[model samples]
Target: MVSLTERTRQGWLPLFVLAVGMSMIIIDATIVNVAVPAILADLRLSATDVEWINSIYSLMFAALLIPLGRTGDVRGRRRMFVLGLVVFLAASALAAASVSGPMLIGARVIQGVGAAMVVPMTLATINAVYTGSRRVIAFAVWGSVIGGMAAVGPLLGGWLVTDHGWRWAFWVNLPIGLLVLAGATRVPETRDPSAGGHDVPGVLLSTVGTSSLVFSLIESQRYGWGGSSPVPYAFALAVLALTGLVLVERSRARRGRPVMLDLSLFSISSFRYGGAAATVVALGEFGMILVLPLFLQTAIGFTAFQTGLIIASLAAGAFLSGGIVPRLAKLMPARRIVQLGLLCEAAGAAAIGLVVSPGLGPWTFVPWLALYGLGVGFASAQLTSVMLAQVPSRQSGQASGLQSTMRQVGAAIGVAALGGVLVTGLGGAMERHLPDRPDLARAVRDSAGAAIAGIREPATRAAAVEASAEATRRVSLVTGAVLLAGVGAALLLPDTGGRRREEE
Candidate 1:
């Protein structure tokens, strides 16, 4: 058997294969959103069941990333990559054939595990195979795919659900998976020669810490943060687990055993700040993605298709910026470019907040969203290159895993924190504006869609719409503020002039 390294000297084929596999994972993250209503109706799923179906994949995926990434480093990246593809492909098939909600959720959990294995390897492999300028280009393409696919997911899901039904969303992964598998054969196998025996305690601690933390964040929106809700308990458990992980990893290092996370990586200023900026970027990006559709549909009366099309403008901007940033890197430092992107995002979000209203047209928000997307494209395209540049090639797998873990945690928090803001704002608006009818106001506060549908009086409907519009406006502003914070974090990154040579 020809080795993957010897077969493809230029490395484009392997890169393309990695991109395709990654696209599957990134697309799956948001593709299910547009199909949820259809799935619920077809499968007779309760609201809780539907929520779990949506949340469980991410929960499992985030939890297993560090452990699996370490496994790939200890074993072989290519081998784990192939195994991940197999698991993902099988789970996709099971999900497509699912007869009940529980079956689908189960399949999704397995799918998340596969995705966890596949994601870190893509970047680690690129870090290994590409050198200098080519390495910079490789990471640019990787980042572009991530940003572009996330934006495309909802549009693609809407089209698939509208035309071929919800099952095709999962089914579409089959051919792509096969193509990736075939190409995987040509990808070089790489691993850490110095990697020691796995620390089982380290794995358990990291898994529990991340999963519990993510679960608490995700569930806090549904189950209020106070009282007997599991949010506080889960959060406390997360803190305990994470602290334990730190102690255990330090012990493992002292004992000369492999640990899941290299706490030492945090010592690098670029890695530390770059990871922080990535998290903040994700918080703004994912929060906006979640809240925009709600505002468009509930406050502005756009259909799902119409909402998706408007959202596509964001993707369009991201694609345009993604293409431009690699060249821009030639002219400016990566840190400055990231700061510029965050500025665009902040400005765009602020613009949206100012302009969003019940009377606003659907097309009115497109330009602002596009600007925000452009920011995402620029930041995402270079941040990975900026951060991973600091890590030695041998440690690329663990670094990539940590990078991904930060982004996931950011996303989960973005949704929960920004989502909570929207909910609270809406309730507050309704309470303040609808003082005459407390019951109706409470109903509207509880469910925006139900409020829109149930309120028959024109005055009441108008008040509810205004309340929703206000809530959305506030959320947009908050999202902008979050991105602005990312700007400050981006400044901490060493001003490496966008030269791949300099990064190396």
Candidate 2:
């Protein structure tokens, strides 16, 4: 077998393999957004089911990361990473074949499982395989992937769905996954010799707690936040279960047992504050990503392909910033760069909110989204540096795992929160504008604002379009506010100057 030294010294091949794998996983998370209208045309999915299809993948992925990441540390990161690829590929095939809403949702759940297994291991594997400048560059590439690929998905999914069909989006993952697997041999295997004794209870509690919370938020849009729905019940379970998880993990840590997450890491101000900002920023960005495509196509009358091309502006700006950040690092602190980027995002989102109208062409969104993308680029990469800067080398894996989990949690909740706003906001518009057409309003709301594009009745379609525009404005403004909150959190960080100072 090739040694870690031998394999990694082969230059950047291992990092390339890992980055491809990571990119495929990240792309899948947002790819569905640009395809939601097409999927609705085929599956006849309800608004609730649409939210499920959009969010369950993330919810499960977020809930499982910490536990699976620790498992990777003990059981061989390479083994887990390989398994994740196979599982994700299989799940993609199943998703393409899904015949019903439940079928697609199930496939998404499996995809999330596969994603959870792959994501942490990729970071851990890179940590295990690289050192010094190589490690820094590798992690920088990883950060850029997270920030850029997310925005790029709409374009790819858009083209695939517009031309071949939405199913082709899933089909496209097969070749990428296979390519990664072929290169897997060059990636060095690693395991922690002292990693032992899994925290089974903590795992169970964390999963249950986080999943319940996400479920409530997503379902709350459909079931109503307060009424006879299970939203309240799920919220209660989440509160109780998450509290139990904290208590259980703390006890395990105190008694010198293996734990899923180290609570003590929060003692580091950078990790705590940086983490808080990362979560909100992800929520703001992803929530907007989900809603923007729906609005662009449904109200502005853009083709799926056109919508994708426009949204690609965000990724374009992000990649452009990726190049700029290295140069900017010499003149300013990383934290300052992060906060600056977030301010860009907030401004971009606010600008988007102000411009949304049924009469407006989708192209009006390009500059703002690109500005937002630039912020994502600067903020995400440097924010990561700030968060992990103070972490001890020995605890790097654990720290990375926790930060990843928090970001996933934010992404999952963002999907639900902003989505909930759109659905409920549209419903309110229906009540006010089309009071006699309750059934029509319900239909439009259940389609996740997709029906507005196809409603042939001129008056009704106009109403639906108006409603959709209002809902989108709400989503965009709320996204901007959340991003501003992230900016605030970034403001709170103690100078995270040391982490990236070496690069200067």
Candidate 3:
């Protein structure tokens, strides 16, 4: 058998290929945000409809992560990665050609399924191919790509939407996906040698549970929690599904069968707390990202290209921090570093919230955005390493899947929760400003972009823009509060000196 030592000498090419593949999915997660307004306008979608378009991707991705991760471990990581790319490529093309809102969202759901398969294989393959200090470096590069690609997605999407059309945002994935597929040929096949049969029950439970939870949250704002609304019913169903999932997994464990997720992993404090911190970070980061573009385009009158450039400042900070994190880890405890990062994120969010105004230009946001990105870089660069440190190499696939699941769950819920805040705030603001015009207020509440388009009076348009800005500001403050909670979660992580420790 070829040792991992010989494999590390294969150099960084494999990691690069994996990063490219990883970036395609991560970028897709947020790339649609920059194009959301355009899609809504083109397809005549309501705000709730647009939210589903952005959210179903994350929802589907989160639901299938564990099952697919288990599949890779039972089958072959390389095989699954290649297969995922093909599905992703097909879905991207379908999404690009979509002429209606439902068609585009259905394509996104398929894309998310492919993403679930691709994401875990990258980290699991990296774990299989590298060891010791080399593994640490590999993870840093992996983390950097995750942070950088997510930050840059909006920028790339903005340019595509500005220069071409919203459809190009999906079409541009074709060449990149093909290139990644070609590069994947070099990656060695890997899997858990002792892996057993699939856990069909666990898969079904997790998928239904998570999807139901996300759907309930996303639709709650549209359909009131009371009266004839289905929100409470959906919430009850989610609770039942998730509770049943826990019972089924516990039963499977007693029988010594393969489990979709090794629930025992949560017993380790680093894994448990690290997953929590990562989830909170993702929630705030993705939620704010979803809202900022709408505020920029609808409230501040920036073009898509201009909005992308402004958002790029966040990526710039993340890239610089990601590059330096490895060196920083050599000097300080990873836990303290993560704490500092969360503090920075919280501070930046607060600053942006306080300074936000309808009259302010994009340039006013650059510094705060960069600060937030720098914090994200520092936190993301180390959290995965921290979480996976206690797991043995054989279980990397499961651990990676769990981490990705948490992040996606956070993202799905963030879009729903923070988006609800934005929508509710807009409604309240409009009502206070225009109490006599209930019909007009309801229209504005449905879609800010559409409302701005319909209002012919300059004074009314200006007031609507102001309301949107205030709503954005309120959401920013909420995001800052969420980051502060993440700081608390980071505090629970053990102060390991950036080194992996064996499970006791």
Sort by TM-score, best first: 3, 2, 1
Greater-lDDT candidate between 1 and 2: 2
Best by TM-score: 3
Whole-model lDDT, model 1: 0.79
Provide the lowest-lDDT 10-residue window in model 2. 495-504
> Where does model 2 exceed 4 Å of error?
1-8, 145-152, 498-504
Q: Please list the Cα RMSD from the true structure of every candidate, rounded to 1 decimal place.
A: 3.1, 2.5, 1.5
**Which tens-of-lDDT digit does each residue in 1-504 have in candidate 1?**
334356448558778778878988877756666565567557866434544565567667777888888888888888999999999999999999999988998998999889989988888888878877777778788777766776787788767767788898798788878988998887878786666577788888877887787678657756878988999999999999999999989888787777888888897778899999999988787766766765666566665567777888887788788779867877888888888988999999999999988899868989998998898888886888788777777678888898988887777667666766776787788888888877876665545333465567888888888888898899899998999999999989996553332333
**In candidate 2, what are the lDDT values of residues 342-368, reduced to their tens digit?**
999999999999998889876799999
Ranking by lDDT: 3, 2, 1
Question: How far out, in Å, is residue 488 in model 1?
Answer: 1.2
lDDT value, residue 43 of candidate 2: 86
Name the Cα RMSD for model 1.
3.1
TM-score of candidate 3 to 2 decimals: 0.97
Question: What's the residue-level lDDT of 359 in candidate 3?
Answer: 89
Q: How many steric overlaps does candidate 2 have?
A: 0
